[model samples]
Target chain A: MIVERKSVDLGELQLDSGETIPSATIAYESYGELNEARSNAILIQHAFSGDAHAAGVSKKDGATGWWENMIGPGKAFDTDKYFVFCSNVLGGCSGTTGPGSTNPATGKPYGLGFPFVTVADMIRLQKGLVEHLGIEKLLSVSGGSMGGMQALQWAASYPEMCASVIPIASTHRHSAQQIAFNEVGRQAIMADPDFEDGNYYDGPGPGRGLSVARMIGHITYMSDDSMREKFGRRRRQMSDESSLFEVESYLRHRGGQFVGRFDANSYIAITKAMDTFDLSLGHASLGDVFEPFDGRFLVISFTSDWLYPSYQSQEIVRALRGRVKDVAYVELPSSYGHDAFLVEAGEQTEIVRGFLASTFKKLTPVGAAR
Target chain B: MASAVDTAVRADFVPEVLGRGDYQIIGEIVADGSSVLDLGCGEGELLAWLEAQRNCKARGVEISPTKVQKAVSRGLSVYQSDIDEGLADYPDQTFDYVVLSQTLQETLKPRDVLHEMVRVGKNAIIAFPNFGHWSARFSLLTTGRAPKTKHLPYEWFDTPNVHFVTIPDFEELVRRDGLTVQKSFFLRGDRRITYRPSLLADSAVFLISK
Candidate 1:
């Protein structure tokens, strides 16, 4: 199905940093129909560098959704059975009010002058959109990576609004290594001469810098085993400055493509939001953060995902189990590294399909006739 | 975490799905509406059965990723974990029943597992093949080999059942550990063998407490 992107005028939104955006708009896409009780709504959150197009062919460019594999008619999310909604986050370039958005105050793109945002602010904007759609409580709030962090935030910050939370290949907070990698990406963008302090709207922007940053990101997203298998020892040529590795060639192509689609300023805004995100911040412990929450949780991690390892997922499960809350956990066997949640959806399709069906069944009360 | 709550999407839960006699006996031992943890729960057939038929809260730990998938698909709460290394995450007296069905012999440290089970649950229902059965004994005495009968089907060299225990051996350990055997059921296929059960029964199930 060809899907059209819709935008909601959410006006001003308060940031976690005590600042406020003059006007906030969220670009979104929805699949399936909302039932009478509005209980079948499942919110799909996007990861860093991802847009609101989570499923269906986009009308703007005819590009397939980012998570099209698992969010279609009979797929894991099963749009036919549940109303699946995805929104571009607060500090995103994809039609959402971010660094790319025109600032009402100056009649120019926010660029470097955009008010700083956080994961909490992202969810807060999404919350406005979800509530605008007339959904009181989501049947589930689900996502992977940064999306997963949003999912956990939904369950934690708005416990009564989410019936269940699915955080896949994600963590409650960024590890030192995770922050370090994101920092490198930010530095690559800032070092570009064309970047001009995020005010490159009148120029070519930071295309080269953003490309190199994405190249670094692509490396962190794959596993050693996958890299070896994908581009063995195949070499076309050799040079001191240019080591003609096929992997390097491939990364360069991917990085260049990323620059064509993503904005460098938004990249900085989103990454900083991700780097500072900590679900347990200020709480005595991780367990303490979830003490008042009663929503069910489903936590998934991949075996080869060193960037966001299975142990991180285990920590969430451990905290939930300690509270005697309803939770399930599995470290699936995969060689796809951090991209397993997106790349490998076969077993996840089965596991998610089952988990959602059971939860929906419980919510639908059988009458005395049964 | 890919392992926990996405509650509403599991397959249709069919009550009375489990037909195993030992599971039925164990189900009887479990109180209605109580919480249960099944170790080595396979695809969580018994846990699903308990949840649907008995209105009990069912949870499980299975080592295989494949089985964990099946159980989650079946609407059962299961963790993918080795049973020996699983219970440490849970607090004391977390469950009404801790089940180890046909899996005790495969454990590297059976005694330690038993101890952990009783510590984690108010009661534990253990079921294992009786190594002292008449057919098993006859096979060992007559052929002078590691007994390979219907119950203990594997050959000695490749057997996964590393710790072979008779009814007497288990009872002695229970006594040594100061555990109380609340109930016991000896089975020869579908029939209960109360007369000389140690020599006649193929498998045995015991409901014990600390």
Candidate 2:
């Protein structure tokens, strides 16, 4: 359960937009050991607002990793069998190069000056990290939401690098509805008086705007059923004169906690990247986007996840049908909405465990250790 | 419950280790190393069996989410969807065989689904309970009520087979649709019946192609 945060200097990175970052640093954490063949590596991509801390308890605080339940000695990722790698994304604030990171040229925080990073770019950078670990091929690449997007990009971009992929609660492209949601969040952050056009690194720094944005995001992460079950029309008494609705108080609390851990500039950079994510950007068809993939796939979606509905996952499955010989898809019934991938780990464990085991059996040499 | 007659013809098929069951017959009919798509593949037992025995690339579609979960847990590729709606997402003749086992009688539009199966696959394997069996005829004649037997176990109100078809009715429909029957099998409780199957057999399986 002991976890340590490590940083790697990726040197200068050329952005997809033709912009160049003078220096890039990727913060990552690893669990378990890589096999002699370096084939038992599983890359875990974190979702929007998530960091490198994926499993085990944090050393700084007594807190568990974001995907603590899904990755451990006996968990779905199975640390004992496969080496699990989780890294903070390129356009992330948590210990990675982002808007918060000081620009080498300016000798100050990058703020809005950070180059726009794409989902494909993130995978390219992650490829650097994987190569640094001496792994030529990986067992699987997996994640949910933005993390899932990165996994999809990995499959599309470097098909031979991984043996399998598990993209849960994710889509091949950002739908108009998804783009609109991210746009609203971005607007909320930009409109705040304290935002100061993303140059408030020296000041209090757009706390109210960022909090509002987080509140909007938190609502979309949950379903109507889950929200109703957690907090009905019940109200909380703040004082004898006034009271607040339970749901309102809950959103405010989540927003407050998010502000402390996240930076507003990084939120804009990351959400914008998610909005522009499309696997079929230059391809003729969605199937063409996945035609080069030579690995097994396990695509999962939640029934109540309106933000990224099951149909989106089905679309990916449809595209992959004849193209990939080994692809499995499941739409699990859950009231947890878009956040089900994180909250409903128990329901996902069996499917994930079976998929990894089967894919591993197929990929491993016959005489290799089990 | 396999009879002596069933054991005699079992040698005709390439030997495969399969448990004695109705689906095992369907599994045996499937060609080795051919891709398969099973409609209404409950819990993916047949698909998994095909993968292990025939070494075929198998996929399935089941309407129930619970069954899809079970199928996924067994490492089978299955999508949760209504088969009656058709396999529009799949390209033409993508699979070598499309198997609709036992669940065809419960479909709202069996003929349309069968047509879709033919369109998406080079061949279609269909299985359904024979409503014109002697036991069902005897029950209807004597009791003047809808037959309720081991194959048709549900009560009138709870029966999923809304449009049950007798063996003759299905044969006529197949002929009318211009589909050719490559092979046919009739069973009386796991015992292969070749003589007067419409009247004696309790279940019918057909391998058809357009």
Name the best candidate (by TM-score). Answer: 2
Residue A10 displacement in candidate 2 (angstroms): 1.4
Clashing pairs for predicted structure model 2, backbone only: none
TM-score, cand. 2 vs. native: 0.94
lDDT of 2 by residue, A1-370 (tens): 9788899998888889999887888999999998887878999999999999999887878678999989999998999999998999998998889999998888989899888888887888888888889999989999999889899999888998988989999998889999988898889989998898889988988888888889999999999999999999999988676889999999999999999999998899999889888888888888898887888889999999999999898888878874644677888999999989999988799888888887887788789855
Give fnat of each prediction, in order: 0.63, 0.53
| C-alpha DockQ for predicted model 1 | 0.58
> Candidate 1: which stretches are off by over 4 Å?
A235-244, A367-370, B1-16
lDDT of 2: 0.87
On residues A294-363, what C-alpha lDDT tens digit does candidate 1 reach at each position? 7678888999999999889988988887777778778899998999999888999988888888888777
Error of 2 at A280 (Å): 1.6
Q: What stretches of model 2 exceed 4 Å from their correct place?
A: A239-241, A322-325, B1-20
DockQ by candidate, in order: 0.58, 0.54
Q: Write the per-residue lDDT of candidate 2 for residues B1-210, one digit (tens) a residue.
A: 445755554443324433434576786678779999999988887788788767888989888878887888888877777888537777789899999988889999888899999999999999899999888888889999889877777889998898888999999999998999999999887778899999998889999999
TM-score of each: 0.93, 0.94
